[model samples]
Target: MGKAWLPFASYNLWSQFAPPVGQERWYCDMKRGYAKVRKREPEVTAILAEDTQPQRVGLLAQRGVYEFHADAQRLANDDGLAQVSQILRLEQESHGVKERLNQILSKYCENPILLGKRIFSLSRGDEGVPEPIRIRCGNYAFHLFAAIDCIFLEPDGTLHILDFKTGRSDFDERQAFVYLLAASYLYPQRRAIASFYNLELCKWSEPITATASQLNAVRIELMRLAQRHEWEKKQYRKNPVDFERIFPPNPGFQCKHCQFNRICQFSTREIS
Candidate 1:
């Protein structure tokens, strides 16, 4: 028989369950339910399909970097940015997207960070649904998804997992830890470290490392969260009327920015 499907966990899922440091006021569990649980619904799917401006900038920036590195000479050539822009079809994008992408491409052309590094892997940022790493914790089992942007080898032979950023969002250390945990499984023999880089701002975060105990704790926490999430899903399926009770909403000014505000009954904004 085929293997039984298990619950899944990721940094995204963790963030949905709990707010990041200092952003608690905007936290809303209902958003999670709309996004993850009932996402297959027509209205929800339509909203999710639309890539916000920030999302577009991030994706294009990552693709720009990938294209630059794909052709080593582009880093040094004066016309490299133009060539990459053509490849990206930047003209077809909105003015904001085109302008921001041009800035990112220019910055990368002037300072190609990965020019000489021994790149292990780099994602173009458009790959959908990375393969899950099957994780077994005691009697519970769940899948862990860590879509790392890049990986390179350090001089000391350590594996360096690098995540790229584009917007003003703060670097959530939980994401780095998730990547480190995945590395521990994918490269058990090698020491691994994770860090974040804002491609737009050219900002680099301090390298993050974790001990075995810390990783174990994260694993257990994810296991519990996965189990709880699965239970919530089952409850919602059994009684759709209990949706609000299962995933309570925190409607406020933040609802204006929520993608599902139009469909959310608890949304503060008028749906006219």
Candidate 2:
């Protein structure tokens, strides 16, 4: 139930978040930054289901919004209570931050793209996509990617991508720009931006827009990346998930609650 692009991702609470490489780094760092980090949901359930969110939101995002829900009942397993405690702590802290951010956003602006959220991957579908598109970049030299969570289409037909942010105010413009490029390449007519929902600040910024030339360049880069991976895969003959040589092994902020945290090679010191 991993994300379409995150071949490296495994399920935690049903594979809910399926965070891309960048987010994985974020997660690892969170665990290290806070000793209280823990697992929020059963890896598989969260990874594979879209029914976990509120019905209204779930229906709005039919593609899947399930991320490890730490508060669910089964999380009470006597084993690994310490880890579970960490997950609960992170989730609650996240909730508090969101409340504050929303309060701030409520006063300054109206909804940017009213009810225009759209998701891309359908991990919860029982039938696998017959011809699902696979995205690869540079024989592991490139970061695997996926887009979901908050597709805000402006009234002027510009599509904006919105991602939820639970912590500080950092933004990844390259990632969003590539998404914009991808949207233009794949959908042709739609204009998309990877927008952020600052759960703490409740503010919106003008998203980075990929110009025609930028989008074209991205397409070339994507093609070259795919070709490079194709050659490496042919030569190495390893599962993409298990392939590690292409990208240097670097763990970052997102691993704290990663399902693979237990097994990530860089997990040298235990975080208890």
Candidate 3:
């Protein structure tokens, strides 16, 4: 699928269907269309990360943590890894990134259980893999924007997908399953596992591993979602401004967190 056709009825979107808010699907379509046409990123102003650490913590968490994992994996492989300069360079680039990274890395490095693991991406290494793992199955496509925070490649070839959470909020296991689904496609030959790590709470979740059959079921679901999204997208292209009927909105509490809530008629009760 083309970049123009993203936000394609993602798992999260499908899960949001319900009530009066879901009734205004058209409004949702218009909001998505406006974003695509204008080439704008989703607005994140409404979201406030509870951590005292700056917003940069999250961005650096992805980059810095990946760097750490790559270096550690390379070292395990006896590939003559060079992480000191890498860490130094990262620290020099920004003020808080290094400090935040230390807090995260210390937990892993200090723990004896986490020391021996070789972390790697399911598709490939950090150097070449795309920022968000994009998967396309026919006309229906969904971008896996949520990167797996850390993946441990076991000796037996099991790929463990780990997501690092900095906050205290309850963990959502579905997100990890999404990564596992992506891994199933990216590295079909290997067995895959998924887990969540809460750095703030210092807790590790029970491991969840999916079977080939379960993953195949998810793949089929995604295909159906993609086809339906493609059909609706055509409707959106025909009349971008008036695509309300096809992509109706179900305005309600979800609007409060919606990036498009500011411009949605059902939410604001005013003309856009």
Candidate 4:
């Protein structure tokens, strides 16, 4: 017989389970319930299909960077920004998206961050579902999905994992830690660091690194999160009606921005 599949964990799941520092007031467990547990439901599936404005901007910004670095000449050419805009078909996007992307692309053309580094990998950001990193913590085994945006080697030989941001979202150190942990497994021999860069704000976070013990602690925490998430999923499957009980809601003003607000009965706002 085949072995049983392990539960999965990612920074996305971690954020859903627990909000970033200072954002606790807006955290809602029911949102995770809808987005992860009952996502296969038609109503939920429909809502999840559409990307929010912020999400669109972030994806396009990352894609713009990818396209710029794809061809080195684009970074040097005077009309590089315009060329990439045409390639992205920026005209098709909404005004907000187009304007934000134009700024991001223009800035990247002016200063391509990865220009001189020996890049190990750079994702276009639309690649669905990165290959999972199998992790075994104590008796628990689970998959760790980390979609790293970019990785390059420093002159000193450290592997640097760089995550890109678009909007005003704060840099979640947990995400950098997760990438550091993933790097530990992927490049067991190489020392690594991780950081975030906000394209819109032209901001860069200080590099983040973790020791062996810290990475192990992160692994254990993810294992626990995976087990808890799987348990919640099983409970919901056993009794669909008990979803709210299993994943209680904290409806408030934030629901207006929640992707699942349209279908969530507990949502505070009446999303049109």
Best by lDDT: 1
| Stretches > 4 Å off in candidate 1 | 1-4, 270-272
lDDT, candidate 3, 45-97, per-residue tens = 22222233443455554554455454456334432223532553654645566
| Native-referenced Cα lDDT, model 1 | 0.91
| Candidate lDDT (C-alpha), each | 0.91, 0.41, 0.56, 0.90
List, residue by residue over 42-121, the lDDT tens digit for candidate 2. Answer: 55334334332232222322221221121233233333333433432433434543344333333212332232234343
Q: What TM-score would every model get versus the actual structure?
A: 0.96, 0.44, 0.59, 0.96
Cα lDDT tens digits, model 1, 38-151, are: 999999999999988888999899899999988888888888889999999999999999999999988887778888999999898889988889999998889998898999
Residue 251, model 1: lDDT of 87
The candidate with the higher TM-score, 1 or 2, is 1
Candidate 3 matches the true fold with a TM-score of 0.59
Error of 4 at 117 (Å): 1.5
Q: Rank candidates by lDDT, best first.
A: 1, 4, 3, 2
What's the number of clashes in each of the models? Answer: 0, 37, 17, 0
Question: Residue 250 lDDT in model 3?
Answer: 58
Clashing pairs in 1: none
Better of 1 and 2 by lDDT: 1
